[model samples]
Each structure stands twice: as structure tokens, then as C-alpha cells.
Target: MKKIILSISFIFTFVICFAAIVADLTGTWKGLIKFGDQKLELTYKLKAEGEKLTGSIVSSYGEIPLTDGKIAGSDFSYKIDIGGGPQESKGKFMGDSIQITSTFGGNSVTNTFKRVAEK
Candidate 1:
């Protein structure tokens, strides 16, 4: 069953690669969000262990904890309740940056965050 063995090997390799991508998401990122004419800067401190992602978002308002966070390959989703109920955010990791989009009250805001280097 050479074909069967090859198939299994391929599947195993893919899983390992996918896990690596998810694991690489641990770091700090910064971005700016615009609400009409006002722009607010935000920072994300993230930690990834397996498929679970735990992080906090720091903004001018305050720091908000990330909830129901999951990382699948290069994509992730997290929920945050910033006084106005819970809003779900979805994002994709791109090289040195990530693009996250969240919807609130039928309006969607997307922020592109660059990786923050550790000092």
C-alpha cells in the first residue's frame, strides 16, 4: 500500500505546516482604526498555543480582553465586548502584518496591523 503510505505522509506534513502558521501568530501588533474623521490607535498583544489564541487589545479607551479566540492556519477570530456588547472580529495573518475586520451596528471597520518589535 505505497499509495496509502504516501497519502498519510502528505496529510501529516500539511498538518504540521498549518500548525506552524498558527503558532507564528504570537506577538504584538499595532494598528489604527478610523471612526468617521477620528482615528484611534490600538495595540494587540497576542499569544498562541496550539489552536487557541489569547490576547488583549489596548486602545485609548482601555484594554479589552479577547474572548472566544481561535486560530486556524493563518486566519483567526475573536470576540470583544467594549461596553457595547460583544463584537466578533475576524482576521488573516499576512507576513509582517494582519488585517482584521469587525462589524458593529451594521458598520464594518477594518484595521491593518503591523508587527511590533520587542524592545
Candidate 2:
């Protein structure tokens, strides 16, 4: 009986930890970029398979594929090509929001994204 109880406890702990990790940024997200006095809204559709992530960004410029996407704990990072310019972004997930810092064309930009419900 004691052994069974211990096994069940371990399973329960594992499930809780796994769910917590998966719950962070496991869906579509939308954000806006602000540079100096200019702002542009963008949408990111993301899918996570295990520790690997796949996504794309939709902006007025066009759709860009997210490459080399990875996630560790609450930290996430990815790279994308926007109009022939390579850019990389990294951030931490908090609740339903993620704050990311991206560098492009020798300029660093910060953005805050909110998780969007899938249609």
C-alpha cells in the first residue's frame, strides 16, 4: 500500500510539472512593435511539439517563417527573416503574455504579446 501511494504521488507531481511547462505560450499570440514613434501590429501563430517550436509571423510586410525555435522552461527564442533582413527574438512567458526583445537592422526593439484564442 505504501509503495503504491508513493508511485501515485510521483505520477501526480510529474503531471503537474509537465502541464505547467506546456501551458506557457502554447498557442497563437498577437503583439505590436513600437520603434521610436512608429508602431506596427503583428500576429504570430505558434505550435510547440515537445521542446521544439514552430511558428510564423503575419505582418503588413508579409508572412515570415520562424526558424530555430526553442523553449527552455519559461524562456523562448526564435529567429525569422523579415523582408530579407534576419532578426532574432528572445523572451520569457508570464501568464498569458510574453515580452520579447528583437534585434534587426542594427536596431533593438521590444514587444509585449498576448496569447490569442485559436479559431
The CA lDDT at 97 in model 2 is: 85
What 10-residue stretch in candidate 1 is worst by lDDT?
A: 16-25
Clashing pairs in 1: none
Model 1: lDDT equals 0.92
Which pairs of residues collide in candidate 2?
none
List, residue by residue over 1-119, the lDDT tens digit for candidate 2.
99999999999998777667756677788988887898889888877766787889898988888999988777888998766766788978787888888888778877889998777
Distance from true location, Cα of 94 in model 1, Å: 1.4
In terms of TM-score, how similar is model 1 to the real structure?
Answer: 0.91
lDDT of 1 by residue, 1-119 (tens): 99999999999999998877876789999989999999999999999888899999998888999999998889999999978888999999997999999999998888899999889
lDDT of 1 at 97: 93
TM-score of each: 0.91, 0.79
